[model samples]
Target: MRTPAARTRAGSAALAATAALLLGLAAAPAAVAGADHRQDATTLDGLAHRSGRYFGSAVDNPELADTDYANLLGSEFGQTTPGNGMKWYATEPRRGVFDFTAGDEIVNYARSKGLTVRGHTLLWHSQLPDWLSSGTWSADELRSILKNHITQVVKHYRGKVFAWDVANEIMNEDGTYRDNIFYKTIGPSYIADALRWARAADPKAKLYLNDYNVEGTGAKSDAYYALIQRLKADGVPVDGFGMQAHLALQYGFPYQMRQNIQRFADLGVDVAVTELDIRMILPADATRTAQQADWYGQVTSACLAVRRCVGITLWGYSDRHSWIPAAFEGQGAALPWDEELRRKPAYDAIGAALTAAAVRRTG
Candidate 1:
């Protein structure tokens, strides 16, 4: 718990090499499930609730159009994150003009389904409107623009989203800060300012800084640990650290993920497996699928082991609509459900993990 900033920063030279090995870590299969074989009384959310945690999934607008897809989503999980609706490009496509049409639709749907929403992001280097990214502006102008965007979006969704990613994927795989447009235009202080503006707009909404590959102890994660420590010392409004946990079985599960969560929890903030998904090389086999199941249980167990780990969210719940196959060519079949909406071994693994955590709470 002592400042990891100094201890970690000293090893900056070797950080980049570890990060380049694998940008992320993560795998899945099929069959029909009947009432008799399933645990009739336990839902993933129900078990998580007993342990004071939540089981959630990320949802995009297109998936909601399919009833079966929507049904499983609303029924199985207690929380949802808009996969793209709340991004700057989607919400404010033009400078000085804004549209909340898409974001609002997702928010209203979550409300109807009794699911709480998580605002995907207020600041990110990708998916930004062409206008903002292309324009060449002075330091003062860009700074104002950033604060305005964060303020406007957070205010629009005020009480609806319980947590806002605030900033997403702001660090590179290496332990160094990413040279995003924000960093180039306004320097590193932009992160602190962005979080503060978000807090001002929606004080009740928990503010988080989210990134991938930080679920384990490594040079990349060490960089974040140091950064969060410095941000806290400066009185930044960072409320949580979100580990995307986008795992790939080929790279193996993250090293000591539980201890990683605990270290950040000691920083005095909540932690979450914000975008959990496990993938493997193409042409899936039985052994690889089983390993994927074990990783899922480990992730759930890691979260349950920490006092401040509040929730777990899959990037998507089914391989049918996954972003993986496209994102990682040859790597697909990443969720607990298969293309036919059938539960896979991963489903049972997660359920067992949550049930065990609930039992531990009572024991």
Candidate 2:
């Protein structure tokens, strides 16, 4: 379709008002009185399941040691993605030498919780092993390396994961392809080759091209929209577009998010709100927390509005284990749960949105 830049930026104000109403209604006396009262009720995943979608969280290996955090994660969410376990650096630290220790741990944990795993990232520009990044390789050599990496990884986790993020963050903010190692060494066709290789390894697993800043209708998202169309026309196996909703309060909400999701869904592929976290300025106040909760509700509502928008996975479900503090200095407290594993305003907002969707489905 046409460029999203041409459309007017809309819907943020309306979504904010909607979230305020939901939070007011959902934050009843009983929900606020008891510390663990909400825990006994239907979870976010339980509500989402009514409308045929899954709710999930990303977990790092270290955080599994925290029993309280792990238990909440396992029970409240229906799916889990390893934040760094399935990445290239963790999976293959050396050339031709593979390790599945980290990924396997997450898969086993997810299985125990009856949560399906989402294989994150077969290919990415960052977090590559020293060997692969340090050495300069010809196009053919890098292509072979990519194929082998994708093939082996997908083969290993074939039936375990429901989907594979075959290629990630491949596009730049301006809708141009990023000058990543794969693009620089193997050219633009590397993405298609990676998808094909993964599909060959596991035909049952859904293949996706994932990236951040694509939740809105803009140049970055427009790039993916065009790229997916081209891939489909070429008979490539592309199953979904992942909008890593790593939102920030300063950036405002994604422009026309629901409409943007609909456009992608219309293109005949599923859309997912993968890696969701609404970060605010450090030392959050009531205003910032409310805004964060509003954004969370808006995202949940947008995904629920679309039939093909399959699921949402928070980057991390709690502030205790968030990557935000380290990654985005001076900015933290991005998740729905606090450091103590207590539900925050955002949690109630998301719950309200999911609850509303469930009611709509059964009503």
Error of 1 at 316 (Å): 0.6
Off by over 4 Å in 2: 1-41
lDDT of 1 by residue, 1-363 (tens): 111211112322222222212211111111122211122224566567888888889999999898788876777777899999999999889987989988998888778767788899999999999999999988899999998999999999998999999988888877777998998989888999999999999999999999998887888889888988999999999899999998888776775789999999999999999999999898889977777777787789899999899999999999999999999999988998899987766777777677667667899
TM-scores of all candidate predictions against the true structure: 0.89, 0.90
> Which 10 consecutive residues of model 1 have the lowest summed lDDT?
23-32
Q: Candidate 1: misplaced stretches above 4 Å?
A: 1-41
Residue 95's lDDT within candidate 2 is 90
- On residues 1-363, what C-alpha lDDT tens digit does candidate 2 reach at each position? 222222222554354346446544334332221123123245677668878899889999999999878887887788899999999999999998999999999999988877889999899989999999998999999999999999999999989999989899999888999999889988899989988899999999999999988887889998899999999999999999999988888777775899999999999999999999999888999978877877788899999999999999999999999999998989999999899877787877787777778778889
Clashing pairs in 1: 25-247, 25-248, 26-247, 26-248, 26-249, 26-279, 27-278, 27-279
lDDT for residue 191 in candidate 2, whole number 0-100: 89
How many clashes in each candidate? 8, 0
Taken over the whole model, the C-alpha lDDT of each candidate is: 0.81, 0.85
